[model samples]
Target: MKGLMVKDLRLLFSQKKTWLMYIMLCLMMSFSMQGAFIVGYTVMLAGVIGISTISYDQADNGMPFLLTLPTDRKGYVREKYLLCLLMEACGAAVGIILCEVTSLVKNGSGVPADDIRSAVVVIPVMLILVSFMAPINLKYGAEKARLVMMIAYGIIGAITASAVVLMQDIMPDLGHSALVKIKVFFDETLGGTYFWTVPVVLTVLSLAVMYVSYRISVRIVSNKEY
Candidate 1:
């Protein structure tokens, strides 16, 4: 597993142009985009970076060669997840720092507490993204995984639209007053504990998803001849 991790990290860092491009994009967005948005963007790019290493491993008979080493299929999956976590965490930290620096330069003040809170929210969201994407890429390869994810997104959007329409028809009061009531419920229920509870819950859920994803990937790879 340690060797696998080193190999993946070396592959990731070998793409100097890609990393440079991502850093430039993040720097540009840090100045222009919303603080929270920049954080999410940066972390998502990091996730992509981690995912790309899988593609590299699959290229040019890399997987066959990798299997010739001591690491097994499960170790490969675990290493990928660990690499993703490390990269995304670094991205989030860098993004927050960039946001603060940008705010200081532009407004002579630090970013708002709410904005920083929102920035932190991106970590769990990207974790879920990474978790969902990893096994799909492993099972179907990158090309087919893209199509699957697009179809999945389309289905999810369609269902959400249908649900919203159904809600509008079933509960005619689901407009302004209902929205306010929902907001009030959340605020009253979570006002004090919202900061810690929401993040902790999301992080735990994301980790669970990652665990499931890891197991699935292991199964998928282990069954393969390579």
Candidate 2:
């Protein structure tokens, strides 16, 4: 796992422009929104940048060589997910520090507790996104998987909008169903006390999804001729 992580980190840092772009983006975004949203965006950026390592390894027929090393297919997938988690941690940490500093400069104080709580949850959310994506990315290279994910998200959003708009007319109180739960969750996490449970629940859910995704990825890798 250590070697695999080192390899991906080396490949990831090889793209200096990506790091610079993220740096500039965070700096620019800091002025436009609060610290929590900035951290959320950074978390998503980490997920995208981390998954690109798979595409990098696929380039020039690199996977075969990587598998020939002292790592198996399952190990490779595990390391990829672990590497993504590491990237998320690093990105979130950087975002928190930057946000705190920016908040201090702007308001003469550090980031608020609400902002910190929201920022922490972004890591688990990004983990869920990466977990769902890594298998699709491994099965079909990054470019195609990216298009698929975009389309998938678009369709889901459209359906959700249609459901919320149309179902309310039929049920009249449909909005009170799921939205209430979400509102309560958000209120507790941001407004009320016990915000820490949000991260704990999200981390558990994310790990469950990642474990299922890992099993699927292993099957895909084992069945394919590499």
Candidate 3:
């Protein structure tokens, strides 16, 4: 598995695509995008980076050629998931750093620490999304994966916008009210260390999603001809 991971990472870094992404990410330093948006965008790009390896593998009958080695289908799937995790983590970290760097450059001050810290939650969100994407990519190859990701990204964006609009209508001050509610619920109602447990719960739930995604990917790959 280590060898498989190393191979994927080597292939990932070897591509000019990876550096092209880095250059694009760095260019965001002048944009006014906040930490959360930056984090989400980076995580998405990272997952796509991992998926690009699949395309490369498919180009010359690479999947069959890879299995010709000592690895099995399960190991290959596991390595892909691991690769996704690693790359997404890197992407999120880079996003956070870029957000801070950009904020410093523009305002001479850092971003809201709360917003920056909350970016960790986006990591799990991206992981789950990537996990969901993996099976489709594995089954269909790179071109379809690109198409699917584009569609998914659009759907998610639309849903997010609609949700924001709905919330604003539901309560004009929903944002402030929700913050107050959270403060009361966590700080006052739960108190002590329980407030921090929300993140733990979210992490566990995200892991569940990732696990299900892994199982689905395994099934998809196992049934594949290659």
When sorted by TM-score, best at the front, the candidate numbers are: 1, 2, 3
Say which prediction, candidate 2 or candidate 3, comes out ahead on lDDT. Answer: 2
Cα-based RMSD of the predictions, in order?
1.8, 2.3, 4.2
Per-residue alpha-carbon lDDT of model 1 for 11-65, expressed as tens digits?
7788899778878888889888865668778788888888878888887867888
- Please, what are the lDDT tens digits per residue for candidate 2 over residues 25-87? 889897678766788887788888888899998888888889998888889988988888888
Error of 3 at 83 (Å): 0.7
Consecutive 10-residue window with the lowest summed lDDT within model 3: 27-36
CA lDDT, candidate 3, residue 192: 62
Quote each prediction's TM-score. 0.92, 0.89, 0.75
- The ten-residue window of minimal lDDT in model 1 covers 191-200
Which candidate, 2 or 3, has the higher TM-score?
Answer: 2
Q: Clashes in each model (backbone N, CA, C under 3 Å)?
A: 0, 0, 0
lDDT of candidate 3 over 48-152, digit per residue (tens)? 788777777789787888887778888888888888878887887888787777888878888875565466667777777777778878888878877887898
Q: Local distance difference test, per candidate?
A: 0.84, 0.83, 0.77
- Clashing pairs for model 2 are none
Against the true structure, candidate 2 has what lDDT? 0.83
The reply for model 1, stretches above 4 Å from the true place, is 175-182, 185-189, 192-194
Model 3 has an lDDT value of 0.77
